[model samples]
Target: MQAQARGRKARRWIIFGTIAFGAVFLVVGLVLAGQSVSLLNDAERARGTVVGLEWRKDHSSSSRRNRSDDRPAAYPVVEFTPAEGTPTRFRSSTGANPPSYEVGERVEVLYHADSPEDAQINGFASLWLLPLVFGGLGLLTSGIATVVALVTRRRSRPRRSLRTTGP
Candidate 1:
């Protein structure tokens, strides 16, 4: 009985941990996804050119706590001229190791109708990366947790017995 109780407790803890993990990821994903949806709905499209690249040097020391020590990242600096406004220059928030964009390359951009400074490169990879990543992880974890709980429950259930009368 004690062993069974322990098993049940462990299984419960597992379920709880999995659920917590999934919920955190799901919430983050939903928030990001919601932001993307809002941007898609109200943002204006424009053609922008990669005018330059900004390099960011990592300042962290090479200690156990600092994993990114000396690695540097580069972000794209784009210039776009709105229909009724002067040409605006903005730097992308995302940075990549090898750099994602080249100077003079034209790309599609999405900017807020009222605030052109708030803009992002229009694409699945740039706009929806966090949403897809977190949502996928949340769904995967939740599915695994469900499967584990079901299997545990099945194993713990009392089996029915069949009896035959005297022949």
Candidate 2:
């Protein structure tokens, strides 16, 4: 009886822990989403060209390659003319394995009119990737917690016994 009670407590702790973890992720995702929206609202759009690619060694934990494979990711260097400033060149913070853009390719850029040096490529991956990834993780963990809670509840229910008498 004591062991059963301990198991139930452990399961409850697990459920609570998972829920807390998921909530943290959800909050982070929401904060990032809000920042992205604010940036877009304050930014001015301009036409830009991929001037070059800056290749850097892939040291991020998200990299999918084995330790032996050491391939560098390519981040685009863009040059654009802001509404009130001369042409400015800035490298994108996001990088891809196969290179997302080619040199001389035209693309949409978003930047503050006052600070053309701080700009970003106006695209789904550039702006929304982090929020989506974090939000997905939060939902996944929350779903797991729900499933565990349901299973624990079902298992805790008492079962009925059948008896037969023969003459």
Candidate 3:
């Protein structure tokens, strides 16, 4: 009986640990996915100008961060009249970098034609990271929740059979 109790306690700890860890990952993934969604919404409302291209030093593609960091990636920020527009800049991970476009280069951005402000550079809307991140997260959360539920149900079943013979 004591061993049984100990076993149950151990199982409970395992479940608790699994739930906590899974929840943390789920939250992070959801946050990333949510941000991507928000970016899309903002892009739809964009009419900003090519304020300038910022070479962000921190953007990296290195397998492991080392003495030599990944070269800065180029991103553009365009300013719109009246208020700043949202859709601005471009990103790519191809081995070759996009040509350096200058501040005054005349370029047209594609956006929600319904609302000019809601827009994006035509070629850039297909970023894969957002979808992959969300899909993997949804799968992980579902699996963990399913396992925890099954363990809980199995543990609650009574060991004795519900039958009686009366003399």
Candidate 4:
């Protein structure tokens, strides 16, 4: 009986945790998606040139274990001229090894009308990837949790006995 009680308690905790985790992901996904839409609508389009690469050495937990981690990862540095303003320079949020773009490459960018320095490379991977991934994972986890809870509850219920009287 004690073991059964513990099992039930564990199940309840699991359900609660699953719900909380799912809710967090869903909320973050929604917020990120909204921001992406707002950026798309409000930002102005401009042509930018890759002026350089911003390199930084990794010293974080995962990188600490490897000896070769001392090498720097490079993020693109882009420069663009907004209308009614001088040329502004900004580094990209996304980075890759071997450098994603060359110093002379021209790329499409979106910048705020007021703050042109706040810019992003207009692309699906950079813009909408996070929101889609988080939203999808949240829906999947919530659905699985709901199904498990329902199935467990159904199996734990006592079956009724049918009584028949014959004349």
Candidate 5:
């Protein structure tokens, strides 16, 4: 019975963890998707040159193992100045190896005319891609977990007929 209780507790924790992760992913995905739409809607958009690439390596625990044999990777930060005279920059890696876009390399940028601060270097246009991928994974995990929980609960319930007195 103790073992069964432990098992049930573990299962409950798994479900809770799965739900928390799914919720966070869904929220992030929605926010990112909304930003992408806002970017697409603004009529005042312009193309800009890469100008320069900001390079940096992430030395976090996750990246430490990945760089065991390879040289440190460089991330790119695309810098651009819109016709509106506002300066903008987007780090290609978000936080990974800075893209190797050399200084003065040309890369397009999308910006909002009214608020040039709301700009992104097309170099990382895959911004939307990230949210979608994570959101999908979360939803998939949530669904699988819900199904498993339901099936487990169903199979665990005992079905009996008191009318059977032969024993």
Candidate 6:
């Protein structure tokens, strides 16, 4: 009985901890989504070209690599002429392993009127990826927590024994 009580207490603490962790992720995801929406509302759009690719070592991959499979990630360097400023060139914050863009390819750019240097490539991956990932994680965690709580509650309910009296 003491062990059972201790286990129940531990389970409750785990559920609370899971909920808290999930709430933090959800809050971060919502904040990021809000910032992205605000940027889109206040940003100006312009046409840009992929001037070049800035290649960087793939630190996320394994240290040991085969000769033929070792390729760095390619981040696009875009050049655009803002409405009221001279031509500007900025490297995108997002990069891909297989090179998402080619040199001389035209792409849409989003920037503030005053700060063209901090421009971003206007695309789903560039703006929405982080928020979606965090939000999905939060939802998934919360859902698992809920399922566990429900199962625990069902199991903890007292079961009555059937009794029969013969006359």
The number of clashing residue pairs in each candidate reads 0, 0, 11, 0, 11, 0
> How well is each residue in 18-131 modelled by candidate 5, as lDDT tens digits?
878887887777888787776667635666565544445445667566755644555555667778676677655443344445656676667766766656655343457777
Which has the greatest TM-score?
A: 6
TM-score of 6: 0.84
lDDT of 2 at 83: 85
| Candidate 5 vs. true structure, TM-score | 0.69
Tell me the spans in candidate 1 whose CA falls farther than 4 Å from its real position. Answer: 57-70
Superposition error at 64 for model 1 (Å): 6.8
TM-scores for the candidates: 0.83, 0.82, 0.45, 0.83, 0.69, 0.84
lDDT, candidate 3, 1-167, per-residue tens:
99988987898777777666666666666776675566556544333445567666564545645546456556655444322333334432212135445566544454444455444443333333545565566558657766876878776887788788899
Estimate the TM-score for candidate 3: 0.45
Which residue runs of candidate 2 sit more than 4 Å off their true CA positions? 60-70, 158-167
lDDT (C-alpha) at residue 35 in model 1: 93
Kindly report which residue stretches of model 3 are placed more than 4 angstroms away from their true locations once superposed: 44-131, 134-138, 160-167
lDDT (C-alpha, whole model) for all candidates: 0.85, 0.89, 0.55, 0.85, 0.67, 0.90
Q: How many backbone clashes does candidate 2 have?
A: 0
lDDT tens per residue, model 2, 13-122: 98999988998898888888897898889889999999999999856675555666678989999999998769999999888889999999999999988788989999
lDDT of 4 by residue, 24-60 (tens): 8988899999998999998899999999999976567
Candidate 3, residue 116: CA error in Å?
17
Query: Candidate 6, 65: how far from true, in Å?
Result: 7.2
